[model samples]
Target: MSEQELKLHVPAVARRAVQQDIRQGNASRIRLRALYFDTPGRELARARIALRLRQEGRDWVQTLKMPGADAITRVEINHARPGPVLDLSVYAGTEVEAPLSAIKGELGLCYETDVQRLLRQVRSRHGTIELAYDTGVLRAGTLELPISELEFELMSGRPAAIFAVARRWQQRHGLVLDARSKSERGDALASLARELAALDADDPDAQVRRGTAITRFWAPRGAAAVTLDDTLTPAQAMGRVAAECLDQVARNAAVLAEVDTLGVYPAGQSEHVHQLRVGMRRLRSAWRLFDGWTAPPPATVLQGVRTHFAAFGQSRDQDVLNETVTPVLLQAGMPVITFEAPPVDIDAQAIAAGKAFQGWLLDALEWSLDVQPPSPASAPEPMAASDTAPEPAFRLDGSATAPAITPTIIPLATEAKPQPLHKLLGNRLHRWHAKVAAQGKDFATLDIPARHDLRKRGKRLRYGLSFAESLLPKSRLRGYRKLLSEVQDRLGEINDLAMAKDYYQACVGTHPQAWFALGWISARLDKLIAEAQQAFDRLADTKPFWK
Candidate 1:
């Protein structure tokens, strides 16, 4: 029952298959990959656990799998098509964190099919792409693409070389390298977990598969995803809020408009400015997806919204740098962090700056929305004077003096009307299988802005879903909606912290020579900001907007 003996349990399928292919005239190549695995905190390596999954496969053969644990079940998929083939897997089990000797001592000699070997089979068929293979050795693929690959890394590593190589390969060759490692298959499974939770109350057959497949399951609580449709003319939708739909979208938009106008307001606090920025972002996202039915928001209006947000965002940034960024840079020995402090009149100066920006925003949203003033750069539209559009339902009718009318909330035919989850989490094995296959490349771009954008998008989708959930049987969808709310709240925290941090850094840099000390202060604050951002990013990545 030793580690060496346990390793021998898996059949030598990969070696044997490669040899067979070599003997045949059809053999294309022979590749070897040594994979190392570890838990998030490096616990597996600390405990000396050698966990790996091997793969080998072709069109006619079933995939082979070798799990670290005897009872482990690994689900995998293979794409037979050309260019950017998809292969995915997930491991679910308990962990033993003992020393290497102790781990070896408790190991049992059990045999299972080799899973990693199938990956080789997949490669054999597609011909290896220039992927950073399991051993951390870079191999050039047929297209000579440079790829940054990752295993279940316990600690982050710098993959600068891989990135460089990939960049060259992309420019010289027709292929592109991808840094994204979280497979779509995993996302689908996670989505399935959420969907199955909703079915457990009535589907007895699904009751069995809950914990085994979905992992730690939780129930839902209150209002969830809300979907607002495009009901009015595009012009009307793009116009001011009316008296009709007084739902979340209108509320969000109004809040955004107010936030934009805060620039012109008499007093602009950092907290108020930050909140306004967030409100505008959430509103913009709602408009992006829902604008299909309504008229698209005007470019000038949207740009004005973003501009005011950016200005306040800048002031907020200065605050953050003084509070967060400077400290990190200082700790990391970055000279910019030690820049001198700004003039002692910082508060007075900020007030002036904030007030001026607030005025511009107010003019843009209020006056601009009403009068189609001619721009110095371009002549005004000939019909600008007559460009009147219907207002939002709520605005047109929210007054007590206005005549009351019934609400008309209808689900579009395109919106899938699925049953909401009831209290208990349950199994729906078939439901997992029923999920449609998604293209994996949809989210390969991972950067601060991309993640921020995703947070915005997820918020929009989550809100829309919440609205739709209301129409479902209350007993079923209520709890799930609550869970969604929790997720949104977590995402919101992360996004806010990130925005604050970015703003702070920029502001410090703006006056780096005079405010070196302020930058140092900002750097120190980043630990908290970074922690919040990470916590939220993890949650957002796991619960994508599509879910």
Candidate 2:
């Protein structure tokens, strides 16, 4: 049967409390020992398919698992075995049979896991759920690693039920989401073990510290830019886009949460925070693009996301001011300056993995996947211009630009028939392009809020292109992307300086030295703004890529 499971990593400190909670409930505890198999070429692992023979108490079960329709679901099939022996023929008539039969090389034991499992079933408002807490070790050759995770498998309920339970556990135990499966983690450990053996055999004279090399490198993860299918409906396309965003955000959030243990990321950079924020922004941008095109997320969820986004922005901006901007100012003759601190110095690790933010992401993903057909009379309409559009400048400082074009209002899909995919994408892209390009004309003369909004609009356009790239002509998209990316980068630099300027503008009253910093920022912004305006003006002569 298909299994719907949500896995979360229990923090070190909460394991005892979680165990006590499990004991208080009527739970069945058992010992599970499982052996995983893969071809020498690792075909199954590469394909994200896992085959295993597991011992549950005295009985044996052979199971195969593969990716499912959504992130939370998986195609799992199990057959009772006489003993601890692997069975390949058990999947002959199953949905995963084709992939199993295609493997050319012989399957060999890759890794094994032994864990103490606590299984309990609970019914909530949404549905019935089977909760399993497993704690043990994953072993590959001479290498071994500890495992502590909670898995919620749906017995008879909606998918959202598992998330509701997970959020409760996460809020109470500081649990963070870990999408990587036991098979995936074991595969990684097996690879590491093989590498160490190879190093030792290849050169006896070479110095290799195995202990130092054994530390798990928690790699950074980001979403791949997708080339969407042409046959998908607008709802399907937007759901796919939102799913990718959630995947990126969830993966990076795990890294940030574990940074306390992992110590330092690759290259010693704070990339997790950056990537998490990027994923969140892309999600918000996609929501803006598809607001009227499909069903909308809950208002409370939207506000929660915005609140977290602002918090992250503050942390990122302070990092920029200290790490990127202030050094330049000091080197150019500005003296040391002490700036006022924010009321709460953000605890990035806590915020990234916290229940409130994580819960909103779960809710958002649920909405994206369950997007309903638009209601004819009460369908969601496009956001108002003021919702995302920049304020027009009162006076133009440069050559008179073309009059702003009102965004095209798309018709909502009816129950009988939805809008054409190509037509829908074209209308939205054209509307976004018009709004951003029109405001770019008077960027130099626009006020602070207007400029910031223009930056936001440009960001939406850039992110939208990635989601809609497959529909546009490749040749047209290439050139348009190049200019759009350049325009976006320049606007980003201006935004950074503007943030720094605002900080000092507020500090001048308390710290007189703040004026010197203010002078430096004001001088620097003039040059950056003129440069950004010039780059944006170049966009005027170039035709819209979507055309």
Candidate 3:
């Protein structure tokens, strides 16, 4: 069977209040102890499959979890176990048997989770949803990590209801969307423990050191990675690409929405915000790539993505200055200057976990996986009569004896035929490359905002070419990509300086130290632009890889 659920993280302060809300529905409380199993080589974890025997009160249930067709769904097979023993025979000839048999090493318990679950089934207009609130500790050897979360599992009806209910809970209890499953966390913890043990094996007092050490939980950091299958239809490619982008957006947003299980935000919270913005931009560029090719998410969803992306802009600007550019200025004999923001104004958390944005993400997820199969071959449009030469109605490529105009020749319908994906991609790539080259010719003459816009265009153009990587030959893109990367890096530095100049200029009235820093940034701007323009010219001259 398949299960669809939206998991959320409850803040440490809000757990009691969340449990109180659950009580209103007459929730049934059960104690759960689940032991996660994986091979010594962690093959199951690598495969993204979780095998566990979880004890629910007195009953023992063995379950196997695997990825489903879409991001939000998972294939979960559960069997009522007779005892604590795991039985592979029960799964023979099943859909999961092949993956199970592929494991070569012996299976052993990696870590265990003991959670108190307050669960209830609620009926709503959209579906029958199960609300499960879990509070527990994950134990690996002597290490223990806390777990507090709420999951809304759809028992029936549409998956949208899960998002709807999740939004309400997030607003009320300050829940953040958590992408990690208990299994993923457990596997990470187990891996860490093994590494720590290996490092201390020769040391005296290793046992005592391990006993006193606290296990810190780190929120999952998702990669901005993409992969595409060349054989996919145009619609499938678009949907899958968008879904991949959304997956990164949601994962990073979750990190910003809430702290780790220990209630501490990770060290690089700003990095999360940065990654979230990158994910949004990637998705936006993908929309441009697939425009008019298929149905897209509603305009409202696109705007919401933009709005939330902008909300994090100020924070990211500050982060780049403080974390990136400031050190360079200081090393260059810059005067003392302080950069800070008023405490109450900055809120990456609220923006990430907001109701409207989360809802948009849910809707966008549906849009991404709603693609139809490839349609039949399309017919050519009828030749038009003109003063200039009129081309033949049919070509010699596909059909025989249909090369010229004839009275008995049949005209095929123009509508409903999906174009060949390769041709469309190739044409679009050429068009974008030409536009980039045209705009980049006079980069130094453009204003600050124009330079900024060109920088953004470069980004989108780079990402578009990247998305076409699998569809084209890898050897062809090497030289062009290197030149593009050089241009991107130089433009990035110029933009950073532009931001730094703005920041210090605002402070010059109150603090005279700002003047020196502003002077330094302004002095470097023209030189960087001259260098960047040369790189852009080279990039513009490179041949399109898809050719």
**Cα lDDT for residue 284, model 1?**
60
lDDT of 1: 0.34
> Lowest-scoring 10 consecutive residues by lDDT in candidate 2?
259-268
Q: On a 0 to 100 scale, what is the lDDT of residue 239 in model 2? A: 81
Residues 426-455 of candidate 3: C-alpha lDDT, one tens digit per residue: 788888888878888999898988988888
In terms of TM-score, the best-performing candidate is 3
What is the per-residue lDDT of model 1 for residues 39-112, given as tens digits with 9 covering 90 to 100? 33433334433343333333321221222211111222222332223222212121221232242323221112
| Model 1 Cα shift for residue 92 (angstroms) | 70
lDDT of each: 0.34, 0.79, 0.80
Residues 1-547, model 2: lDDT tens digits: 6788888888778889988877777899999999999987899998889889999999999988888887788988888999988878777787777888889999999999999999888778999888899999999999786788999888887988987787787778877787789998899889878867777655654345454455444556765686677588667777888888888888777767772254433322356678878888898888887777677777976897788887766678778888877888788887787655656567777777677877776677667667665555775788886786754544466655555666878699666665566667767888888888788989999998998889888888888888888878889889888888888887887888888888878877887877888888888789888888887887766786564
Q: Whose lDDT is higher: candidate 1's or candidate 2's?
A: 2
Model 2 residue 244 CA deviation in Å? 1.6
